[model samples]
Target: MFASSLAVVLLTLAALLGAIVAFAWAWRKGHFHVDARAATLPFDDHDQRVARPWETPSQARERVQAHGPPLPPGPGEWGGA
Candidate 1:
């Protein structure tokens, strides 16, 4: 009798765990994300094919010359720029 009672408890626990796992699996696989698209997107199917921003000549020059002719550091901070 004790053995049968233990088995019942074990089976009930197993069923509960199985149901929880099944629900999680279905939620992950199904269209549960549809309603949350607005909040979830702008990242989910993120724009992979975005066009590169046009860089003006001055912007390019600023980026390229920001380092400027390797000016040496002053005082105790040597090792060229």
Candidate 2:
């Protein structure tokens, strides 16, 4: 049982490595060149471009309107509209 289980684990690891190599071979043949800027864009200064959190006064108005009218006080009466 020990030897069989070890063989199974080794086979699974070999298959996983083979899959990664196959992927890399295809990518290299296609000349995939991902630039450093593309990788860094998500962490760049997005705060500077947006200027404001929601961008405009209309957006703030929409957010304020989202918090319903008022809620009734009770276990069953929880409707905020």
Candidate 3:
């Protein structure tokens, strides 16, 4: 029982130490630094104007006002497999 408890404690400490080291390495390598452009890397022009079918005319107008006119979806752009 004592051996098992000690093993668990040692493993927990090792995992904690590993996480700390990984975080320090990432920090030193500037992995945490993010610019506005880099933050938008996953999105494109199409992502800016996705049509929401459920929106009422007023809601559509509000969306257009907030994000400019909505662009028509290209062929196969819909999630149909």
Candidate 4:
């Protein structure tokens, strides 16, 4: 049991050390230079897909009746409506 505990402690220390080294390497390579650009990546053209907005139960039932159950929209559709 003691040996297993020692191994776990060693592994934890190694993981922490590795994380510190990786962070240092990234810092040196200017990965942190452009804070705003990184923050806006989710808004880029390729990544700008909007999440499906919530609909009330009545709206869902109406949509199902009109459109035969909800599905992902085609290119021109907005919310499949």
Q: Compared with the true structure, what per-residue lDDT tens digits does model 2 show for residues 32-72?
A: 66665677555423322222343377764553455433222
Per-residue lDDT tens digits for candidate 3, residues 10-46, read 9999999999999999989999876757876776767
> Evaluated with TM-score, which candidate comes out highest?
3
Poorest 10 consecutive residues by lDDT, candidate 4 = 44-53
Ranking by TM-score: 3, 4, 2, 1
Local distance difference test scores for all models: 0.56, 0.56, 0.80, 0.66
Query: Could you tell me every candidate's TM-score relative to the true structure?
Result: 0.33, 0.35, 0.45, 0.37
How much is 13 displaced in model 2, in angstroms? Answer: 1.5
Ranking 2 against 4 by lDDT, winner? 4
Q: Using lDDT, give the best candidate's number.
A: 3
**lDDT of model number 2:** 0.56
lDDT, candidate 1, equals 0.56
Error of 4 at 51 (Å): 38
Residue 30 CA displacement from its true place in model 3, Å: 6.9
Candidate 4 segments exceeding 4 Å error: 1-3, 36-81
